[model samples]
Target: MSDDSSMLLDGLPVAFADGQTIMEAAMAAGIFIPHLCHHPDFKPQGSCKLCTVKANGRYVSACTLPAKDGMEVENNSPDLNDKRRTMLQMLFVEGNHFCPSCEKSGNCMLQALAYELEMLSPHFPEFYPDRPVDASHPEVLLEFNRCILCELCVRASRDVDGKNIFALSGRGITKHLIVNAESGRLADTDFSLADQAAHVCPVGVILEKRHGFAVPIGSRRYDVEPIGMQVERPATAGTPGTRDEQA
Candidate 1:
């Protein structure tokens, strides 16, 4: 695929390859588009809807939508941000995200994006689902309460680690992450700390047993910089504060 195509991301021109998705092009050009399930390392799962943007008048998931030449995309608009903020609030309320007490506080992508999107509160009523915690694994801990259904761990486990340790069950709001074992425990499965699944969780769901608070609050990944800056992108000459751009 040739890398000669170009598109307008919020009026700024972004060059893309023939097969590159809008998200890929934007990121390559150092344009931050907020997302959770569409990691660059994994297949683009458009389940999280967080990367939805207006492309040529219609809304589409930037991570899944292929970039076209001369396409006009609106990313940081007020309406789009408003919708994203609502989604963030719902995600917060859907799970028991006690960010202060959680081990993934400063390093969590969800938490960082919430702050970036200016999510002041979990606007809707909280679900507070009584999910189980799996401490049966010798080296890893599984907190179901923090699962955002992003399926990053599932992908990592199946595709990268080839362990198939994780899967999702149920439907709609009842859908949840489940261990791929008859015993329904992490210990029953071959989930190792070395597996990509152990480190791919954007939230506090899949965690190590004793590594809590190893990094201080102010020095964690997102603590040092925002989530938008977590991924390395090509630096543009004029955009001095591209990292601080509206994500």
Candidate 2:
């Protein structure tokens, strides 16, 4: 018979409450499962597919897959990691991510994951898509070139900020992030730097102006510790549910 409150994660026992997803259970147990689109504060969106794991011989998104008693989840396997590496590489090349110059470098989940997954280079040809840099907002800057389409901003804006200032448009390779304004400008919306969406981005897409490199390169969040370790330690996740908690 299956235990009602526990399961096996990678051959290790893990206990979880009812209604917790595999990712949530793993996270509560301090097990690192690579993910991009799922954050604790928002409803799980499984859009990134980085958290896909083998659950009882079937592949499913850990973020959205409910944790069942006695279920065995395969995470961190070589096959899974290899696939995740390829996905990370695709994300890197799909967007214009100049990490060295990005304000979000050490604090960026994507860059940190690339290092964690040992993705040395963007394995595919760069699209180098012509995106815009919207500095129309005085306190914040929107660099669309580095957006990975994780929709953190979209969820945060609509759910938390209640502005619905950001949204994803188009489809597939043509899909891109868009400001929900008639002029296609962030300033045209009521997005403020204080909003939750402004701080939830995993990449360099949304940044604050006039504060670039304020934390320095080497002393930043992921610079001091890998993302996995940070996730395991909530105290170091930044601001106790405000800053970098989604990271």
Candidate 3:
């Protein structure tokens, strides 16, 4: 019924409240919309454009667009998936994301999303941009090579942690994460391992030092179960994060 305050997501009815976005409603209704740069705690940012969906004949970011009653939302279509795949390919080529050598191989959202979408190969040529690794912090490693410019850490530090430790510099392809200190190092700032910014990253850009390979191969977060099945669906029984928290 139209009075039920529901929207048609991929032809299925999904109930949503007044303030909930399509992504939020879909997640709550057990529907998956591929997204990055979107955390439940932070305001919606449409930077990644991975969750683009055709709603009422127009394309919009599912993460930011509010779900209206009776609206038709096309999330899992070939055209939408193709666009998402192309964007993922650009992201892969623009950064130096060697998944095998990275610490967040299985747990990383980017890697997991790519796998879920069945992104066979990075279509474009790799940019291989020279980004520096900031190991100034004792417990953290800032590997800029794998950064997707999601700005999750930036928001977490500024909005949540009140530290304002991270920021984005430059424009277009030159843009990258920068520390807000005079020394331009993480150690110079008041950032710590316990900060919310440390754990908000969905990629391998920010990692805890000395904790690499702590979970071991084939037993990582997404290694056993896919990210969609893990995060989108509630843990049924005997799940790691479901029974006990991770990190």
Candidate 4:
């Protein structure tokens, strides 16, 4: 398995293509790396730090680290999993993620990763910060309570939608997502439900109006199965195509 184009991921050999990052190669090889900020369509930001992996005796962001030949990558381990779980817990407490009442409960990547990581509890005390919900837009709701600051929407809006509608401002604990309008309101912006940014959010931060409970509680995306299974699954249960392919 020690080929010129292969790298060792958890002792298993994985081939990599030129210019592919560790996350990209592993994902293409059916390996599921826990991540929130990484989407197949966008450039890897490594902002979430959920996909951290031990590489060559040091830790590196899998989403941004380039895959090198003969490199040793430890993705799944007790210590690594604990760190990932703690990260997930921190995200939960920092944000007001009430899954029971959240419209994106099942479809939310944050919630799904919590379930997949078997996050026992918040582990840390809740911050309970009072964030705002902007419902001024006619077709969308900006629920700050569920925002994880992944910035996928920001990238999608700027890079794909060709509309610089989203941006992150402030710093540290005060950091939050913002719209690019003078009024600081989504209604004042040119955001649309059909915009690529509208669909890139991993959590319930950005949601389309009138379809909060469209899929029902029990039949939503992750309710049917774990997020790991969903992404790693070769088929869409009985559907025609692969989720990875479509994603």
- Winner by TM-score: 2
RMSD of 3: 3.6
Candidate 1 clash pair list: none
TM-scores for all predictions: 0.92, 0.94, 0.93, 0.91
Return the top candidate by lDDT.
2
- Runs of candidate 2 with Cα error greater than 4 angstroms are 1-4, 232-246
Model 4: lDDT of residue 115: 86
Q: Which has the higher TM-score value, candidate number 1 or candidate number 4? A: 1
lDDT of 4: 0.83
* Candidate 3 ranges beyond 4 A from true positions: 1-3, 232-247
What is the Cα-based TM-score of model 4? Answer: 0.91
Compose the digit string of candidate 4's lDDT tens values, residues 100-217.
Answer: 8887877788888988898989989999989889999999999988888999889989988899999999999999889899989999988986687877678888877887876777
Model 3 gets an lDDT of: 0.84
Weakest ten-residue segment in model 3 by summed lDDT: 236-245
**Per-residue error (Å), model 4, residue 180:** 1.1
Error of 1 at 239 (Å): 28
The alpha-carbon deviation from the true structure for residue 32 of candidate 3, after best TM-score superposition, in angstroms, is: 0.8
The candidates, ranked best first by TM-score, are: 2, 3, 1, 4
Q: What are the per-residue Cα lDDT tens digits for candidate 2 across 1-247?
A: 3345788999999999888999999999999999888888889989999999999999999999999988999998999999999999999999999998888888899999999999999989999999979989988889999999999889989988899999999998899999999999988988887787887888888878877666778977889889878655332223554343335
